[model samples]
Target chain A: MPLLAEGSFNLLSVDPGLVFWTVVTFTLVLLVLWRYAWKPIIEALDARNDKIEGDLKKSEDLRKEAEDLLKSYSDKIDSAKHEVNGMLEKARKDAEDLRNKILQTAQEDATIVKDRSKNDIEQAKVKAIREIQELSVDISLKLLGNVLNQDVNDEEHRKIVLRELEKLKSSN
Target chain B: MLSVMNSLALVFALTLAQAPANNQGQIVPLQKVESGVSAKETSVKEDGAEAASADVHESAESFDLNEVINHHLGDVRLRDFYIMGYNFPITKRVAMMWVAMTLLLVILIPAARSISRNAAKRPGRFTSMIEVFVTFIRQDVGENTMGHHSRSYEPFLLTLFFFILFCNLIGLIPPMGEIAVKAGELFGYQFHLEPGDIPLPLKIWSGITPTGDLSVTATLAITSFFIIQISGLVYQGIAYIKNIVPAGIPWIMWPILWPIEVLGQFTKPFALAIRLLANMTAGHMIILVFLGFIFQFQQLAIIPLSISISVAIYLLEIFVALLQAYIFVFLTALFIAGSQHRH
Candidate 1:
């Protein structure tokens, strides 16, 4: 009680000076902080938010574009595979037709060569028989003439020998 | 946690230092009473005689708890500033407000620079921490309460929050006066002084909460009141005057309801001022009262109980300091928002 009386202190006593100082101090703090601190910080926060949102949207678009490209590439690969299969099928059919044509031509040439050689052998045999018969008629006429003292005709003997040889070939 | 420990140490040291000075004034009568009682006991040592002496002793020892509480809570006029032929008294609370203002400027200006520099990048730890508090004040308190209009008022709200917060937090730390006294005592220099005898340099960095002062809180509340009223007038125009009574009331009841509703506007800020003042003062009062118990009972057994309870209350005071600052700003924002709209 003595200290309170001596200091003249009261809990609810109003002090106008303290209030004036507080107002001045608070106003200064508000002005300094508002100018240097709050404005820039809020702007930065908004900017960072916008940048993040834009980056997210850009990434989403890139992902969709990549997906589209992948689908188109896969479609191209599928068509190429189909074209390759068709080309193989056509090549195989062409090779088969060429092979059949070559085999048929070879068989025909072998048959023709065999028939021509058979005809040549038959003509050669007929000429050789006709020449042998003519020679024999000349030698027999000469021997008979020497025994009976007379000559025989060569043309009629040759003709009669060729005819006999032909008859013999036909009969064989 | 270290600051809290330092604060506890300081509080204990302050109690120990003040104890002797306090005893010099208070314990002399107690000693005289004891001698008288002992002299009586030597002649006739009866139970009734001892009880009567104990009652007499209690009366003789004058430890005024109200005086101590008031002396600490009340503002001390440090000096007078003369301007324009008028004197403005500078008190301890005013100096404390200057301290809070200095701290705000010193700490927040650099933080603001860092934030602006790092707007496109991540900020440093300290800057980011400051940003977190600023963001909370803007987004949670200002934006949540006032919506888009909060942008214009964010500066005022932020200043109020930080200013009150610094004042409250600074009060929790032992005042420069106590620290100086304790430091002097540690070096064998003793000071036996009253609350007013504390020197100006030591007194300027006040340990007392400015918000604990009714004048200071009232000033802040008055500011908030103006902002609320101005916002109402600006947003709602002249209709704001009529809108205070709310809509859909009977026209006959306007005379009755209008006066009470008009008074409600003043009472809202009045409650705000008182709420902050009481909350800030109560914690310190409880702590002081608990510490006062040691001297009152003059028992060693009560020291541990008193100090432990004081420490508990001191910790609670820290929490209340933040909570009260938050509550003051949040309510102001709410009131401003409320005023701008009808109902």
Candidate 2:
């Protein structure tokens, strides 16, 4: 056995010592492996998983932020259009009021000129009628005076001449 | 000469127990071994007819190393009751086996203690490495081998792989470091020391690879073989036996392929066991022999060649220690996987 211990090229055989040791070694190794090795491997994987999830969430948040910024920009554009429209409507209303005031003053001035022109025409017509009536009566009286060879200027003189003429005709 | 005689006698005593030898001296003459060379003559006598020399020659052409190796195991397996006898020495193998076990307990228990639930971070390097290996085995081998109950086998496979790895590594180291033993005991027989009792073999560094022995390897192979068969039987039953021959064989070819398939099953694991033993064992021996050649062939011209060869082989042996461990684990996984398959 001691000679055997001095390792020679021995052929394959079961050394009882070798078998016994193999079993004992196996048991001890199994125990260590259960506790130290497998447990840590699982833990590391789980940790890595958590880290990946957190990264995904951060990306989602950034995406949402981008979306919000886009929405705000669109809303600003919409309100600008509404504001422009309001200003245009106000300007149009102001222009319409100015036009209406000028029309009202023009109508009032036209009415006043028409009234003054009608009053002047009526006054002229009355003056002409009075002149014609006075001229006719003056001519008739002059003719009468020539034919009768009498001159009458006042009302009392005329009345006496007429009475004297009438008495002479009656005696004839 | 006395030492040679004793070695001869030791070898013979172990051989005759297996079978009876005829007048021609070949035991178990029923079958011819793979080589055509007949194992007829055990002893060599120099014949004048063969241009004989006085120096004894070990016949490489005729002898089988396998037979001689098995011969060393003796009658340990034959006895109904477990007894360690004069021919069989239990004391040596047992003591060493226990020492190996103790070493395992001492090393692993504390390493396990360091791992905890509150370990907010991962464990230390060794612990993390172990974890990675466990996960790999669990995913690759365990799930496939054990199915839904893979975790159950995880503990067993992981433990077995490391245990075997550790033992093989230990075998490669010199058991007793520089402390010289003036004398050593063999099966209660006190070996006398002439000042320095160490043999050239033991004094040199040898590590504890147990697969080097046939008995050790055979036992391991046989155990795996039985486990594989039993699992197959339970999982696939008679259909499992049918699948062992593979599906495409013509019914007419069944007779020939049948025995071969049975033999093949045993052969694969046998090869696994022997391969591990041979690779590690041969590497160690090559290194030993090379170093031995250094002094044994003391001529000046041979010195450089011997040292160079020995150094080269030594480097190769270091790689082998790791290689054997991988092979054993891989083969074990393969066998387990094959057995699990039904079709």
Candidate 3:
């Protein structure tokens, strides 16, 4: 083939100088890039990946904390609502008891006052009737003396009047 | 898009159908034309393509596809560098390797600094872009293949990957020689360099793919081979020799299996070198071949089709360049991993 002909270019020909240079170039590149390029770059990539994973874990933890806080706050609010309801119920019951006690005391005082007033009326009526009966007996004795009627005694007259009044109160 | 496809199909059919017959007719003339060009280069070093009418017609009639393909794929010796009483001949590929090296240092050193500086913060676009490649080699290629031992081999793998990748990508760009020639034409001058007469500037700026050269790839594969063997020895000690053959085979089979297993070790790297060299070289060769069709047919009608196909192949070449770099490192990692274990 013309491609492999003598003095013509051979694609497979090995040039030792080129090989040497390639080796030198590649070795230098590997060393230099490893120090300045590949090492730090790779480290940075790892750091970034780690940072990402860490951030995700941190956020996850924060979300869980927030949920816990929410739950606790809701629980607190529920308890406060329950306490307020209990306080209201206790206040209403206490007010009802106080009202019932006040009504009982007022009714007792009113009954005592009414009974005392009835006794006062009964005493005044009996005293005033006794006084009037004695005054009528005195007038009858003075008129009998003037018209030939002799004075009757006070004790007998009072006794007769009280007995007759008692008979009349009973008959009426 | 359909027309482009149709035109490409027509070109492929025509070339495939007529290539052998056409080769039979033109082979002698093609060789003659190659010799003529060389003779012309030597005789008329300064005057560019000032030929007789008959010679022009002959040159037009014969275009050697092999010469064009080889010219692109083969290495050109630029000059000899004498250092410490030793002569080191610098080829285009050697210079390109240096270019790739310089490029890696220029682009990556700062990226490394930036990464180290802002390791906690999100990196900039450029730094992050480089980090993606470095991380891919470390994690995807290195860690996946070698597992925990990947860390130890990362620097080598990363260097191998970026170096080869840069070389492959740089190859796709138009070489300084071609660009210089075109620039010379625009200025009404022709830039022609006799073999070994490349200017210092042109030599420095030569843009060939180092990985496409067998010598370079062989060097890389040789390094990988050593690393693999050493890793095997380091992990398994001197017993690595015995471990090359799988365990549980009959003791009687040892005599037959040992040599083949050893040979398999060498062949793995051999395949790596050739695979890289061929893949990198073939893409450029195919592109040149497609473009060569235009001159071969000597018709304006072939230009569009040839260019379109070349463009398509060129795009595929870009993908192939990255893929081949990835494959080289990945396989090296696999080989290294394989050596570290018995089965």
TM-score of each: 0.73, 0.52, 0.80
Candidate 3 has a TM-score of: 0.80
Tens-place lDDT digits, model 2, residues B2-92: 3343333223222222222211233221111111122223232122234233222212233333333232222112111243633333332
The candidate maximizing TM-score is 3
Q: Per-residue error at B234 for model 2, in Å?
A: 3.3
The 10 consecutive residues of candidate 1 chain B with the worst lDDT sum are: B28-37
| TM-score of candidate 1's A chain against the true A chain | 0.55
Report the lDDT of model 2 for residue B174.
42
Q: Model 2's A-chain: what TM-score?
A: 0.40
Candidate 3 clash figure, as a count? 1
Indicate the residue-level lDDT of B153 in model 1. Answer: 92
Model 2 error, position B141 (Å): 4.4
Q: Alpha-carbon error at B198 in model 2, in Å?
A: 9.8
Clashing pairs in 1: none
Query: Where is model 3 more than 4 Å wrong at Cα?
Result: A1-9, A47-85, A114-154, B1-37, B40-59, B82-87, B188-196, B299-301
The number of the candidate with the highest lDDT is 3
lDDT score of residue A50 within candidate 1: 85
Instruction: Choose 2 or 3, whichever is better by TM-score.
Output: 3
lDDT of each: 0.74, 0.51, 0.76
